[model samples]
Target: MISMIMVLNQKGDIMISRQYRDDVGRAAADSFRLQVVAAKETGTEAPVKRIENCSFLYTRHLNMYFVALTRSNVNPALVFEYLFQLIRILKAYLGEDFDENAMRNNMTLIYELMDETMDFGYPQNCAVDVLRLYINLGNVRPQDEPEPSQLTSQITGAIDWRREGIRHKKNEVYIDVLESVNLLLSSNGNVLRNEVTGQVQMNTKLTGMPECKFGLNDKLVIDKEKEDRKPGVEIDDCTFHRCVRLGKFDADRTITFIPPDGEFELMRYRVTDNINLPFRIIPAVQEEQGMTKVSINLKVIANFSDQLYATHVVLKVPVPKNTAKAKIKHSFGRAKYEPEQQAIVWRVKRFAGKAECHINAEVDLMPTVRPKPWSRPPINVEFQVPMFTASGVHVRFLRVYDKSGYHTNRWVRYITKAGNYQIRI
Candidate 1:
């Protein structure tokens, strides 16, 4: 019984060895056949001659046999050795300029071979280390009559590539390996790692510009001569005159204005004296119906010496008399009023020692008279005039008025004045 068992075991071993030899022979034959076909398609007679050479055939068959062994179903230890040998073969091929399309096709074969043995699980560290070795070998530049000994020495001194040990798992690992191999083949040398390092450094440097802030107290001063170019007020080119300071007040501050056409210039100043307090004066931007609206914000500080009193804001606008008419609209909370003119008058209800107030004034334009003769009529141009006095002092409503006057009643005619003048008091 013992003799029979020994004979069976020996027969089994021999059968396995024969199968392994057959697999290697088949792989080498298939690879050589493909190479011959490719050579014929490209009309390359040299490839056929080289394959026929004794030394070339021997090396080719040995490399293909190793590649076959690496993909075999048994002996994982031998598989690792064969994989390393295959790496060396790839390094040699990649060192020379090979057809990019052909290399891509061959890589698919290699992928399949590697996948088949994945169940046995490759040594994670060995795979990375071997890949690193291949990367170093592929980076060597070819010289006239390149020496294999010199190239091998250079690769040996290079850092171990496998130190990272397939850091990424599953699909990522496969993808990275494929990319590394493609890069090596494409460059005819290893330049991908260096290029990637440079890109990362550049990206880091670009992400460092400082953030900007438009602070509340920051003022933008406009140089009238440099900024304005139009005949009338240039709204778009206007700059912020003063940054609103929280505590102190900016009294008697002036802002220079330039007309759009550059034909006229005006200087505007804010004044808060014993009779008035610091307030914001906003200019009208648009006209609706027959009125133009202007917004105003008035604030009286606690330490301000002036007693809270009535406030007045002035504005100037050119209106074509034949085409446009002007009216004033003012609102204080829910209370609203519209008068026929350009100035707004604010009356304080109670002397609240110190208080803040906001008022909106709108100026609208309308045609003073219709085009038909029957519809035409005389129109009154009224301007708003504001007056303020001490509490005990009795002041008449008409104590102060605009130099342009209260109202101008003019008859509509074809030769009527072409423009209306608005003045804020």
Candidate 2:
């Protein structure tokens, strides 16, 4: 339930504004521009500011502020999620051109999309794939624009994500299980907080409406089947797309639903327990002789499979703001001084697992008139491990049933990526 939606540029100029209810006025737009943008207040400090009995909840995008106004005390999460979904859909349509210029060029299509997505301040069938079915942008209305009733019927249908009479030449499905592990490390090499956030993305190229059932290594399913309950990670919490049937999942812990045609995020989950950390970073910084010069010793060791290698490994180690120059030495990587960021940047093209690399840097600080104490920042590490998952999450099975019963093949992939993986220096 949103009453009004407004898009403003970085300069607080309204690019677009739409009012769904009479209670929300045009003046609410100026109030938001004045209170949030002009005041330079972040959403963290004041996410929801009420004026004239209307609440304006806003979030900043790349070069715009997406402001949502609601008269009733509706769910804030619902509003924010819808706003994000709106952006994703636009980006899907515009691709790399999803910016201010793109918006200006496609204003007509944008308004049409806004009308299709929201009605009476409630979201309808706004899934990008589903929307692209009828809202043809190419002037050739995708076979003469099926009548309004036909489109509306499909929109209100149970399987709105999939259009009827859909068929693909190949009968195959590919599922990608990708996880990003985030960690906040304390000084002296201690793990302060760590978690794994994962997503299951599916690309289905099949014929007919295939009723699919997905399985995970959940405790309830394992206990009911009396199967081999292997030692794996537990999914703490999960959220699924609308295509996923919530009733069936709630009843049997089974993911039973009709997936969308193209690539769509099926489910997202978080794992906190039993996270296998793949890297260990040790950093030591101390005064070599005086405050002007400091010596730093850093070591990065990969703890995963010895046969595998991490790609695009980057380490950003911070130094004092008055860093004049940095003498860098490394074992298996290239290290350089980044004066703009006041940090020592290191890079390794390929880091073999079960291997270790080291970096040593002597940073000379410029003589500052006022020598203040330095507050060191963490050393952030970034890498991608293919065919690996830090959470140990595996797909148990994917069973598909269709009226056609055409044979099908399934493919699965696993990847682990860095999500704010840092070590306090």
Candidate 3:
């Protein structure tokens, strides 16, 4: 439970403060500025800080800080989640660039929104859509206002995300499975770290309160089936949208939810086991002639099917800081020495699958007084491939049910990209 909410500027001065409960005094707000924000400036990751009987949970957006003070032992996740929700709600009402100036102008409306979202010390309806129905910056017409009974139902309803009577002529559901592969490779061709983070994004245009049941080729379900006992993609951890019935999913490995209108992320998952690496980078760096010159060779091989190709592949190969010039050559991409970055920037517009590309560079070092050894930085890579999943995860089925029993169209697309991918030279 939140006792007080405070919005502070970059200098830790209070901009907008609201007190929900009298348990925590106004001095608690000062504690956050002194202890939390001050410590944060000195490279401290204090998202939650306890001071004098009050606990402060805060998040920073631009130059403002949203903080919550609580006296009781509250769920930290819920507090942080509510803080994020408050930020989104304010952005929805105020424009995206809502800064100190905007906050000053709409102080009254912001306070009203704070009162509506949190009652006493508990979080209530924080749906932006529902709040916009009654609360408005401009004058709301009598005809535009919803009935009292309808408004009450909406605020107290189980479906907090969606409104009633949504229609579509051609019902369609678009699912996009996007996975980002992060890899850290050692100099001796060893994968130090390999991880794939993925998300299921859905764009729903179906009418009525349609229930969606999504299925993935998960190892848990495969083991439960007990047929063939073949292994599936192992998900380390996953989080679903609030609309999903978590209790049902816990009982059975079945994902079921009543999706909101338009586009929303259905779920996010992380995978570490058996990651299908798309690219294999082999690097050889040699210091020639007593560190006066350096020779670098790199081989990039694609490991996917030959049918699909990757686009906009960029590889940053680090060079010495005090380098005179670089003579670089590549087979499949354009390579140029970037002085500011101190690296060879290579760009390949189209990289065919099951293909190999090579790069050779001879770097001449500039004579320096101290002659300090160069610290070789890791090579960073970035690319995107359509119709591919680095985690080898596939959607088995997507079942939708509604009272109208209308026919719906569904489309599924897959994309794999590089994220934090690096190779030590």
Candidate 4:
């Protein structure tokens, strides 16, 4: 349970503060500003900080901090989640920079939001659409509001993310699977650790309470069905949105959920097995008599869709602090030395599928009196492929149904991007 919610700016001024229960006093607020904000407490440590008898769980968004204070033992995860939701709601109303000005101008609406979202230290309906239906800049008159009974039922209903009687003539659902691959390679091009983080985002424009079921070519389901089949991609862990029925998913490995309106992240998952890497970086560095010789090569192979091309490929190669000059030769794109970063930045406008690219740079550095090993940092690469998933995760099916049984259109796309794709030398 929460006792107080406060928003503090960078200079420690309280932008918006609300107390849900008397268990927290105004003195605690002053103390938080002094002890936490004034002290410039770093967030690398635990998020939950205890000052006197109160526990504070806070997160920063934009130039402000959203803090929740509680005296009792409350769920830390729930507190953080609620704080994020509150930020989302504020951003929805205030556009960009939902900061002091936005909150100050809409103080009444903020108070209404705080009261409605949390009552007696428990989270209520915090959905943006639900809150916007009634709470706005001006007061919502009784005549302008929906039926109290129906609104109340929607708030406390099973599917709170969606609203009632939503309509879309197109009745279309588009699912996009995006995966990012993170890699750490040794100097000899041997993989140390590799991981793929993926997210499934959906843009739903269906009407009349459509029930949806999503299917993935998951290893667990495949193994249970066919024991002799070759093992496919395995998901290490996954987390779904609140709309998904966890109990139903646990009973049977079925992803059944009532999707939220508009755009939302349906699910996020991690994969570590059978990752089809799209880029391989190879590096060779040597120390000459009076200068350093650096030779680097990057190979971006399009592993899927030979005709499709990857766009916006960038590779960053770090250099020594006292680097004198660099000569770069590349087959495609632009490569130049970035003096501010002490690194060579290379960019490829478009890398074709089933194609390879290479870069070689020779650097002449001023000799130093004290010889030391160049603490070479890992090379970072970033690229995006339109129709490919690094883990080869495929959506087998997406079935949607409603009481009205209206015809619906569905579309699916896959994308793969680099996430800390690094190589060390």
Instruction: Give the winner by TM-score.
Output: 4
TM-score of 3: 0.89
Q: What are the lDDT scores of the predictions, listed in order?
A: 0.25, 0.85, 0.89, 0.83
Question: If ranked by TM-score, best first, what sequence of candidates would result?
Answer: 4, 2, 3, 1
Ranking by lDDT: 3, 2, 4, 1
Give one digit per residue, the lDDT tens place, for model 2 in 371-393.
88888888888999998899988
Better of 1 and 2 by TM-score: 2
* Candidate 2 runs further than 4 Å off: 40-45, 144-150, 223-226, 367-370
The model with the greater lDDT, 2 or 3, is 3
Candidate 3 backbone collisions, by pair? none
Over 292-404, each residue of candidate 3 has an lDDT whose tens digit, in order, gives 89999999999999999999999999998888899998896798999999899999999999999999999999888887777899999999999999998988889999998
Per-residue lDDT value at 170 in model 2: 83
Estimate, for each residue in 216-284, the C-alpha lDDT of model 4 and write its tens digit: 888887767684364557899999988899998887788998888899899999999888888766676
Q: Please, what are the lDDT tens digits per residue for candidate 1 over residues 206-262?
A: 111111111111122123233432222111122231222212222222321111110
TM-score of each: 0.16, 0.91, 0.89, 0.92
- Which is the better candidate, 2 or 4, if ranked by lDDT? 2
lDDT of 3 at 402: 97
Ranked by TM-score, the better of candidates 1 and 3 is 3
